[model samples]
Target chain A: MDWHQLWTIISLPDNIPIVGMIFIIPFFTWFGLRQGFANDRLLEKLEGDPKLARAHHRKTQPFQKGWARELPVWPYLLRMEFLAVVIVTFILMVWSITLDAPLEEPANPSLTMNPSKAPWYFLGLQEMLVYFDPWIAGVVMPTLIIIGLIVIPYIDENPLGNGYYTYKQRKFAIWTFIFGFIILWCSMIVIGTLIRGPGWMWFWPGMTWDHNRLIFEINRDLHEIIGITSQPWIGIFGGLVVGGFVTVAGYACHRLIVATEFTRRILGRMSLLQYAILQALLIIMLALPVKILARLLFRIKYVWVTPWFNV
Target chain B: MEASKKAAAKSAPLATNGSNGSRQLLGVTVDPQEIKQKALMDLNAIKQPTKTEVYKSIFRVKHDQTARSRTLGVLSNVFLHLHPARVNRDAVRFSFTWGMGGISFYLFWVLTWTGVLLMFYYHPTKVQAFRDILYLEHDVPFGKLLRNMHRWAAHAMVLTVQLHMFRVFLTGSYKKPRQFNWSVGVILLVLTLLLSFTGYLLPDDQLGFWAVTVGTNMARATPMLGHEGPFGPQFGMTPFNDVRFALLGGSIVDANALLRAYIWHCIAIPGFAATFMIVHFWRVRKDGGISGPNRIMLESEIKPLRR
Candidate 1:
């Protein structure tokens, strides 16, 4: 293993955030879920004893007979905020002193940067360019992601877990978020930053970036693999395949939404429009991994192709 | 002699009215012993500065340990007033909210101050931008440190904002009354990204130039607006008059693009982002402060759906 090569990538000033993120994301996730699980255990205890539920404060936080439910912002919250500011300033000061921001040679349109990447945050979208057209990856996907996030509260009809963390109470919501944010968005950014090297080729973590390397893999469209050459037939077959995948995926998401009695009750609360939007978003989200798998494992390129676009 | 007699008459009644037995004539009072005692008392009160007129004028409230003073401490100050006078006892715990939102705001302030300082040395023209950065790094006093702080704080802000959103989602803080504020937050998130993207082009270095080139190239495939996008040609879009052109101000990343990015980064987008941030924080207060680490509700207690 080329430990030097791995170190070079990790030690790059711009890559530090992603490296930090690798630990920060999981640490925070575990930190949050730990509280969630603790709340769940408390929830179980309260559910079994209605008398304690009525008398008890119902929060995991310690309480006494006459303690105030709220604290003064002057000394309590303000002190915390002041401490946070000081801590953040210290971190920023040390970071700025130690590491220099990157500045390369003067910009020349004639010379191109091999494997030119966007800011670390946009790397997830840049990575999507490998699997889809720029229109879909760059424009449509970001728009959809923003819209989906905006509509989350309007779409989520479950009322049990409001204002608190509880994995058992918000199993579907929490899992979906983990899958979308932690698994999809963050992992893609990590892959784009560390794994994808010169010429935009995949290099294992410790592998040297060989600029002259070449792979002879041949990728084919789904219709082409099935030997459909005519224009009308190709379009029709591709459409059918895409439609079938959507139908199956939609059915699976529906089944999961109605999996438990609690979920079914939550699902019942959603209006038809809410349900439809949720399913559409879920299907589109699932399509990304499906397409990635198709391209990686089977060397399948486009599943659907037309004069206007390809998917 | 007549004026002196009239002044004495006026002063004699005022002397009787004065509790300290000071004599007054017209607007002037003459009482050496009383004035000396009053001055001594004032000097003594200065030891407790909070009781002084100057401090009270600015603060407009007592600084004693009373509960009223504590509440007014947060409620009366312009900056601190954004926070309510009181909050849930558990909300102050670092584990509850992770304190990411406040950190994100702090970083924004850091970026603003550093960015303003950097701007004093920067010129946005194509000829000067790169050289200015080099000058900043090599010659300007603490310019390198200033720029580094701005850059790192920006990166830090982005991470913290995302984590803040994640925490909000995990705690289900976006439910019910907070739904609209959450939407506002998503817009703020977009603005934050755009702000970072625009700033990336300011240095005019190859790293920034090409990174921007790759980023804006994607806009060229924006379905109906871009020249190369599907049906774009049919709608009369071209390299000279497309969405990408609007973004770059030309067919390629050039002088115009640099100017555009500079304007957006330093002026327009910050203005927009600041406005949205105002709305976001205001709504947070209106929506009942930070959504809690409240008691978890049982599934059996699910309220009936309001048709």
Candidate 2:
């Protein structure tokens, strides 16, 4: 591509190229390489190669005695800090030159933009507003996220994967966090910032942001799609559906994961409250995938939409 | 005598003997050791160069492999206390920490400095805000660069903070004694977002205005907390008493909202973030310098060989 074409693509709205530089490409590289290294160590351990294991130790941990090498922070940590500063300074200078920050006409409350957007970081929550009402998407879900993030450390008890980068050892935590962050959070932000256009319609990359055009699709609630009425009894049945699903899924997961007597005993050691909270979190996480599928197959807008709230 | 000789050797061997080692600066022979000793003193000391002691001080500590030197090198400095004196070799690896935290801190400083400078040129009012930005572009020298730097640095800071949190999670650094610090980090992350959001409204441009409008409208739907939203009137929420009113100081994004954003962007949010950022870094040291693969790797090394 020509330099002009390349620059246009690089500086596209949401700065998708910058995202790759700052996150996407680097994340996969680090994760992929680390996973490979971990596998190699596992293989060496399995093969009973004492020398290879020692070599691995030497590569990862040079200090034979203590866990740390006791290198002075002056030139080690501080040096890295200096290097990071220089590198960041260089990047910022180039970015500042290449793209000026967006400055539209003076804000007129009377004349709203075609598709006004929140800051890119909040696009996930904004995208949630498309699927649910304001209360649940804006307030309830955000509050849950804060509480969930804070409680993670206290809830996790398995100490095998502390202070390490072992994918196999900490698969549950790693995968769950990745799914929550990349899929639920980052992908939604990408969609909200890049794809959503005038009148909040989906626009592909090649599509123009034409205000005159109207995008149409039928969006329905789960009850309507399933041929049910929105009466009190139907609402109760809907609640029962969710409750039953959770119970069945939780039981099956327990049976599958807690296979041995030893494993069951270990799980039984957890406090009742912790176990309950964990099950609720698992249900919420699993519900996202189900919600996405429901939307795709039946154009479901919300699974539960009460007078006060929607989910 | 032996210690002095060793210190001299460590500081500079060939320099001590060479004629070029000691030079005349303004007709005075400049002693490297004396300069080092003077540097050891606190900032309060304002003695003349000649008046300061010529003896070796802690700052004169040359390149030595002793534990005390290593510890003293970090402890004796005012700026270095944020970091542990001695970190594990693995902790300083580029890919390990990814230097995201450091980059975030650097970007914060850049934004703060540029924001302060830009404050001299820009005003917060609706009438003056847009005009001030235009003036900054065409009238004020280097104003464009300063504003752009502040803007981009704000964006970069947000990105880096998220990346730092991701690294911490990916490495499983937020566990046990570090749990509280992780919560503090979460607060800092939220505050970073808040800081960036507040700054977004300062330009008085259409992008920021409509963004603030759409964003604050989301607040209006805050259940019983907003008057105009779904469940607010069911409770006692009124136009004057709702959370949206509390945030905007009125119903709409007007002069009050703009002023509040300016104050928050300049002072309040940044102040809160700085306080929490300090705690976050301090907790990292207290919980053991940047969690490493050391513990697990050591375990693997010590484990009996198995086929």
Candidate 3:
């Protein structure tokens, strides 16, 4: 086919924005997994080569006086540091001259901007606001993330893969962080920064920003779909069901952990407290995708909604 | 004639001896030992002549290519204390650390220098903040360059700090005794983000104002500390007493917010981060410098070896 025909074929799903998912999601997923395998192979090669491994160990062995080398820091580190700083300064100077930082009109409280956004760093949390209550998405989740990061070194028992690149040895840590940083955090930021347009709607690359064509989908809560009445008994029953769902889900995850020797070994390294805390955090993270799926499939805005709180 | 010439040469020596005797007779006694000492000093000076004493005293360190002086030079100098006398050869490799940690430090220094200069031209007040920026961009000589450098350096610092964190994580540099340092690094990362965020509000332009608005609104959702947030009533958090209240200094982003951002961006957060950064660097050295290339021996690896 000619270029025109190719363009037309690609443009077929341009109007149907979500249809872009067919091209993006699987492509990135496959690419990510392939890259992961490639890394694993590279790590294996480095690890398996006896001569290379011996040389590496011998070179670094003297420094094992706690991960340091006896080489003088002055000429070595200072020279490197000085060179990097000079180059970086030059680059920054050039870039700063080339582009001006963005400036918009003065702040008007009455005129709320469409697609109001936080700084790029917080765009992940901003995108999370789309799926959950602000309290949970902005505060609780970020707090939990900080806590989890602080506690990782303590909870992680794997002593291997330190000071070197070894994907096979620290696969879980690597993949988990990648999934969080890349898929959850960075992807959301990219989406928030670019794909999101007026009214916080997804405006794909090929599409134009048309405010008139905005589509509003009224979402229903899970309780509303189940036709639960606002009676005292029903409220109690609803609370019970919610509690039951959590307990069952937690138990199922616990069982799955022990069901396989592979998984059991992973958790076997942690104490009961660490395991419980980490598993609970994992479950909370798992709920994010589940809630998104619920919204996509069933048009459920929320699983829980009450006067004081909503989730 | 030959006899007369010999007699004249002998008279010449006698005349030289007679002049020396007359010079001594005038006053000062010259010891033979003193004369010998002067001759020896001159000989020693000739043997080890000074070629670059002025340059050496001013700039060149007393590095005699010996271990003792090298260590002493680094240890004695307050400025050089930041670096150890020696580092792991691998540690100096750009690919190993990606020079990111060092770059972050460089950017921090750049920001500090440019920031102090910018402060000379900037006013944190709402009325003058935007005007000051415009004046700096258009009126003052090299003002725009200084501002741009500061802005870009701030952005660069944030990015480099993140990359540095990623490098540390990937290399598993945070393992073992480095764990506590890792936690401190995490705090530094947060401080970096905070510094960037606080700085975002400084320009008082639309981009900054709304960014600060949206960013601080998240603080309002903080569990017990925000007036509109969860558990607010239990904590008796009003718009006056909430965390967001303390952050913005009010319910809305206004003069107080601008001032607060200025204080934080310019002073508070940097001070906090700098304090941690000192600890971070000190601990890096204390923990035996940047991590080496030794593969972390996990329990699984050890089990195989034991078997």
Name the candidate that leads on DockQ: 1
By TM-score, rank the candidates, best first.
1, 2, 3
In model 1, what is the error at residue A8, expressed in angstroms? Answer: 0.9
Per-residue CA lDDT of candidate 2, range A220-297, in tens? 877787788857755766677777778877886566446665345435555678677766776766666676677767
Query: Where does candidate 1 stray beyond 4 Å?
Result: B1-46
B1-307, model 3: which lDDT tens digit per residue? Answer: 9999987765553222243443242235555567889999878767765434654565455757677767777877888888777776676776566777888887888888888899999999989998888889899998888887777677667666766777777777898779999999889988988998998888887777787888888877777787778787788988788888899988988889999999999999999999999999999999987886554443334332121
Per-residue alpha-carbon lDDT of candidate 1 for residues B160-198, written as tens digits (9 for 90 to 100): 999999999999999988999999999999999999999
Which model, 2 or 3, shows the larger lDDT?
Answer: 2
Candidate 2 CAPRI-style tier: acceptable
Better of 1 and 3 by TM-score: 1
Return the lDDT, model 2, position B210. Answer: 88
User: By the lDDT metric, which is better: model 1 or model 2?
Assistant: 1
Residues A44-86 of candidate 1 have per-residue lDDT tens digits of 9999999988887888889898899899998999999999999
Q: For model 1 chain B, where is the 10-residue window of minimal lDDT?
A: B10-19
TM-scores of the candidates are 0.94, 0.82, 0.80
What's the ranking of the predictions by lDDT, best on top? 1, 2, 3
DockQ of each: 0.75, 0.35, 0.31
DockQ (model 1, Cα)? 0.75
* lDDT: worst 10-residue window of model 2 chain A: A1-10
